[model samples]
Target chain A: MKEIVKDIRRWQKQDKKIALARVIDLDGSGPRLPGAAMAVTEEGEVAGSVSGGCVEGAVVLEALEVIKNNERHIVSFGYSDEEAFSVGLTCGGTVHLFIEPLDW
Target chain B: MNRKPQKDISIFDRVEELLNEEESFALVTVVKGPPVGEKMIVFPDEKSGVGFEGSLGNSDLDRVVSRDARGELTAGRSGVRNYGESGEAREETVQVFVESFIQPPQLLIVGAVDFTAALVKIGKVLGYRITVCDAREIFATTQRFPLADEVIVEWPNKLIEKIGQTFGPRDAVCILTHDAKFDVPAIVSALATDVGYIGVMGSRKTHEDRINRLYEVGVDDEGMTRLRSPIGLDIGSRTPEETAISIVAEMIALRTGRSSIALSETKGPIHD
Candidate 1:
């Protein structure tokens, strides 16, 4: 979230609706950690990231719903682990993200 | 549960303020309980109950969750925790996300050389608040180290006296000044603090000679044990940029208490 502070504050100043998606848990080896976060504006502007580019698209959609419905959700993206055994596999990792409107 | 929010200070604004000011705090949010999305801010330095702002829709739940948030903050961890709605144990009626926002560790580079510039860049990339210090004003300017959080023109001992109070296990002191007159005083002052990694740049022979001088100045074997005389790991790095990567990698390995060996040599799970 610190990486997207300027964007968050910018959206806030511009009065743009925004949602936050944070990686709350990890089931296996992954590039990002639990505290990794991504912020999305209502119109699809994004800052930061929740994973190594795999689940971010899905998280953006989820964040859009969070902003539209004004509801919080724990959305898990479970990736296939078989291919991850190969060396230099960057995307096959599982992450649980908490998506919520920045209402508070 | 009926408490009012602070005047003109939303929890998000407070969060940004705390982060910018580098204050250690935790943000707690109820993700799977009544009044979901409700949030609270917890400052671990404050007393229980008094430390919290905002509510989790119940007084008892707020009390319990805020207390646990402090524990999570101290650990510098962020995760979801289960709890009963009324704060009872061994129940999962409520799920609270405790997100810790600890201050970044300080990286004190007691040199103003080309390696210092490289280190400042890499240290910032590793999320360290870097400070480059040297008595040479010509070299210690911000123009030379634009990435450094602070560029101080002072002797190592004098600078340490001013900022050493906050140096702790998470902090690191890298003495890139290979000169004996500069590196020796830097090492001594760094030893005075509890800064975790003390990497002094020198060759094996120079390190041996420096050790003799240190022994002469009363740095015992215990103190000598704390020093990583040749600085970074044996990665055979030749350039300043490569040396910076090796140095920060050494810092990470030291902080995690890992052996700094390749994963292929070990048999355990790669993640751990």
Candidate 2:
């Protein structure tokens, strides 16, 4: 979150709608910690990351939707999910993320 | 930069300002409970009492998360916590992410040896407020330890007594002055504070002799247990730079309560 704060502030100055995604929890071995964050602008630009390059693409897509709807949601990706998420960590860990617009 | 010094600042602006200033605070955001995405900020150590803003839907939940956020801030940790919808003791309805942004911890090195410069350099790399102190005015100088944030020429014990109260569980006190005349008192005064790490640098014989001296000063078994003499891990580091890495690694392992073994020998979650 601290690392991506600068990007969020930059986008805010340009009046760009930004969505923030942070890894809130992990169930197994993960490349990142719970506080790992990524900020995505409405223009598809990205700053920081929430995973080991494995699930970040999916997170960006989720963040784009968060900016579109201006709503928040808890999204997860991993092999353990019963929903059979399209992306999973190569480390075989489950990452839970909270995606929401940086509107507040 | 656009924000003026006034009330009614948005939470997002205030958060960016506080974070840029490296202030200690917590941002709690509800991600699971009703009315999700509700957020609040907590400044636990403000003089006027707990400073807070916004809410997580319910005043009760806001109160509870604020309290927990304060604790997490003290521990320098960020994570999600569960609670009942109305902030009950053991319910899972609400999950608020407590993001703590704290100042970097302090690293006080009580010895102006050549090794002290190496430690100070590594300490800065590790994001610690490095302070190098010694009674010898000639040895303790900014020129000698340019990387040190502070270069103080004072008796080790006096130095610790003057600023030891500020030391907390996140801070470290490393007595690199193996000379017992300076180190013994430094260690004793350092023990008076609640510093999380107290490492003494010396040879095995020097360490054993320092133990006797510490005991004579009435530093009992409990106090002795906290000291890490012959400081650092068994990494077989030869040079001062390598030794600094060993000391920093030891401190990290102690803080994380990890085994300090190679990843190949370890299993389970790599990041916690």
Candidate 3:
């Protein structure tokens, strides 16, 4: 979140809508910790990151949806040990993320 | 649960203010309980109940979780915690992520040596507010180590006197001064503070000699144990840059309480 402060302020000055996605929890070998965050603008620009690269695309999709619908959600992505085909961490971890609009 | 939100401060607005100011705070959302998505932000203030927002459905549960959340925020740690609907001990109906926003940890490196330069660079990469201190005015200049956040040409003990009170469990004091004249006072003063890692660099013989001096200065067994003389892990690092990595790795291992073996060599689950 600190990394995107400048960009968030810039976009806000331009009156652009913004959404924030934060990794609230992780299970297994997460690339990033819980506080890792990212921001997405209405124009599809991005700053910061919630994961190494594996789940960032997914987080971006969720951020866009939150901006479009004005809804907040806690989204989890990972493979269960029993399920081999899930979008698990490349390092084999599960990450829980909270996606919300930066209305505040 | 009918309390009004603070004037002009929505829950989100309050969160933004907390984050922007780098104030240590935690946010607790009742993710699975009766009032899902209802949340409260918690910051430590001796004046009880002043900075809280929203509430858990049950007063008992809210009180317990609020207290626990403040503890986590103070420690600058985040994790999921379970609680009963009324914040009882037996039930697990709600899960709250006590998300703590804390200022970055500080790294104080005494003696602006080559190792100090490397440590400052790597420490910054690890998000530490690096301060390089040395009595020699020529060595402790910003031009020598541009990466350091502060360069002070002062005796180590005097600098510690001014800032030691602020040292916490997450901060570090790295004594790169192998000389007894500097290392002795630096280690003595650092021992008096609560800084988590106090690493002193020296050879085996030099460390032994320094131990004698440290004892002469009235540091007992308990205080002497706090120092990590011959600083850094046994990675056989010869270069200053590699030594810096080893020191930072040791610091991380100490903080995380992780076995400093190769992760691949470990047998059980990777993250405990």
What is candidate 2's CA lDDT for residue B156?
Answer: 90
Q: Could you give the candidate ranking by lDDT, starting with the highest?
A: 2, 1, 3
Runs off by more than 4 Å, candidate 3: A80-85, B1-20, B29-40, B48-50, B53-65, B81-96
- Write down the lDDT that model 2 would get: 0.88
Worst 10 residues of 2 chain B by lDDT: B1-10
- All candidates' chain B TM-scores are 0.93, 0.83, 0.83
- lDDT tens digits by residue: candidate 2, A1-104: 76787777788889999998988888878888877889999999999998879998889889999889888989988885566657899888888999999878
Q: Which residue window of length 10 is worst by lDDT in model 3 chain B?
A: B1-10
DockQ of 1: 0.63
- The best candidate by DockQ is 2
What DockQ, between 0 and 1, does each candidate earn? 0.63, 0.67, 0.39
**Interface C-alpha root-mean-square deviation, candidates in order:** 1.5, 1.8, 3.1
Name model 1 segments beyond 4 Å from true.
A12-15, A79-93, B1-5, B47-50, B262-267
Score candidate 2 by TM-score against the native: 0.85
Q: Decide which is better by lDDT, 1 or 2.
A: 2
Q: In candidate 3, what fraction of native interface contacts survive?
A: 0.36
